[model samples]
Target: MSSTATPTVEIDPQTVVRKVTRNVIPFVFVLYIVNYIDRANIGYASLQMNKELGLTSQAFGLAAGLFFIGYFLFEVPSNIALAKFGARRWIARILLTWGALATAMGFVHNDFQLITVH
Candidate 1:
């Protein structure tokens, strides 16, 4: 009978954890700040956007409501996609898609377009 030996690898868990957190947290924090700014910018924009688009308070309110509704509807599916596709690829795709849509939002001239883009 022949005996085979397996080699054992040693890793420092604390060091690995510290390195990952140090590298990842800053990027994630920046993303959170950007997302917060994007959401809050709508309130700021409404001051000018309402008058320019001729959108009434009710219409604007509906659009705002729809935004949250859409977010709620997609949150689960997005999480599922993230799990399936992995975070790095999924995050890049989401950021690109969001950037394109946000840019498109700036070009909208009417309530329908605003609602659709937002």
Candidate 2:
């Protein structure tokens, strides 16, 4: 009988830690900040939007409610796609798409526009 030896690979713990800290940590932190900012900016705008748009209580409620709906619908798929594609490109795409939508929101002239867009 012939015996075959398997190749073994060795990695240093310090190298792993250094790579995580230098690469993964900063990317994760930036993504977290971007995610937080994107989620909160709507609330900040809502404060002024209610006044500027002369929105009723119901309209304000609807607007806020719809944001969650859109977020819920998109979040899972977007995140899955991000995981598949890698964070750099995926997050950039997400930011650009949401940023355009957010900018368009400012131009909405009526409740219908808000509902449709959100």
Candidate 3:
């Protein structure tokens, strides 16, 4: 009696690595590029904003730089909370915070208002 079995093909490890790198690296690179563009856009916007709002260069720079402080303050707490609450709920919380901040941002007229919004 003869028994037939389906063939199993073995993929080369380097080929698998190369395929994954090709697929994932493009997405990562694109995301990084987008992030860079966003930061650059804000910097350009700040130039116009400083004049319109009558903000001194130092005041505008201080307000702009404090954005990183807010991120830094929240990031660690967010990661710890995410570990406890899971991604869905944690992400919703983050989105809610962002939405509130964005809504408040619309009302900002001066540097103090901008700094205080968050």
Candidate 1 Cα errors over 4 Å, as ranges = 1-11
Candidate order by lDDT, highest to lowest?
1, 2, 3
lDDT digits (tens) for residues 1-118 of candidate 1 = 9999899889999989998788667656756765776688789999999999999999899888998999999999999999999876787777777767777878989999989988
Ranking by TM-score: 1, 2, 3
Worst 10 residues of 3 by lDDT: 30-39
**Tens digit per residue, CA lDDT, model 2, 1-98:** 99999999899999999988987677667667766775687678777777877888799788779888878898899889989999778867766676
Q: List the residue pairs that clash in candidate 1.
A: none
TM-scores of the models, in the order given: 0.81, 0.68, 0.59
Each prediction's whole-model lDDT (CA): 0.85, 0.77, 0.72
Q: Evaluated with lDDT, which candidate comes out highest?
A: 1
Residue 20, model 2: lDDT of: 80
- Candidate 2 is scored at a TM of 0.68
Error of 1 at 71 (Å): 0.9
Query: Which candidate has the top score in TM-score?
Result: 1
lDDT of 3 by residue, 41-94 (tens): 547767777788888988877877887887788889889998999765666665
Each prediction's total of clashing residue pairs, residues at least 3 apart in sequence or on different chains, is 0, 0, 0
